[model samples]
Target: MDYIIKNEKLKLIYEPGKGAWTYHLRIPNSEHIEGKWGEIKVSGSIDDYKLESRNLALTKEGDKILSINNEIRTAINKKGGEGSNFNAYSQCSINCNFSLSVAIL
Candidate 1:
């Protein structure tokens, strides 16, 4: 199955299967990435997703994070299949400086 998460500043579509969840993030452009549409991953749940891409390495630590609606998050040294930290448009470098809008009325 698939899931979707959105807020006043971002939209996330979770695609399941393959032992991992791929999150498609849509947000406004930020200092690090051109926040149009980017893909992130989580080992098990969407609640703890990470935006990791060699094209736009958010950090060297790899354990980058993203905060969604101040609700969900990823964690540092995320081991196994759970965490509290995540990455988005800009991987996971700059502070949260992004926005999103509702597509449907």
Candidate 2:
């Protein structure tokens, strides 16, 4: 599922499961900015490590800002299962060593 943050002039869709990406952005009465999106990148020693977002919560929502938080983890292993395709499942197999909080204004 996608989380939406919006105000009178703009709208944003945050997709934590896909690399903590802001997958959609638009201004009112206008088309979404084609080919443009946002993402958060975390890197370290392991070049092939994958980052996943967990414990996503909307900590704040106000006229001036929107705050979202996630416990970030790198998937060391994964087990394919028959269930919802949320990335939190991948995070369940690892320990969270990073935290990310995003505030949009």
Quote each prediction's TM-score: 0.21, 0.16
Candidate that scores best on lDDT: 1
Worst 10 residues of 2 by lDDT: 81-90
Which pairs clash inside model 2? none
Cα lDDT tens digits, model 2, 19-38, are 43333221222121121112
Clashes of 1: 10
Q: Model 1 segments beyond 4 Å from truth?
A: 1-7, 18-21, 31-105
Model 1 Cα displacement at 102 (Å)? 11
lDDT of each: 0.30, 0.24
Model 1 CA lDDT for position 57? 16
Q: In TM-score terms, which candidate is top? A: 1
Model 2, residue 15: distance off in Å is 2.2
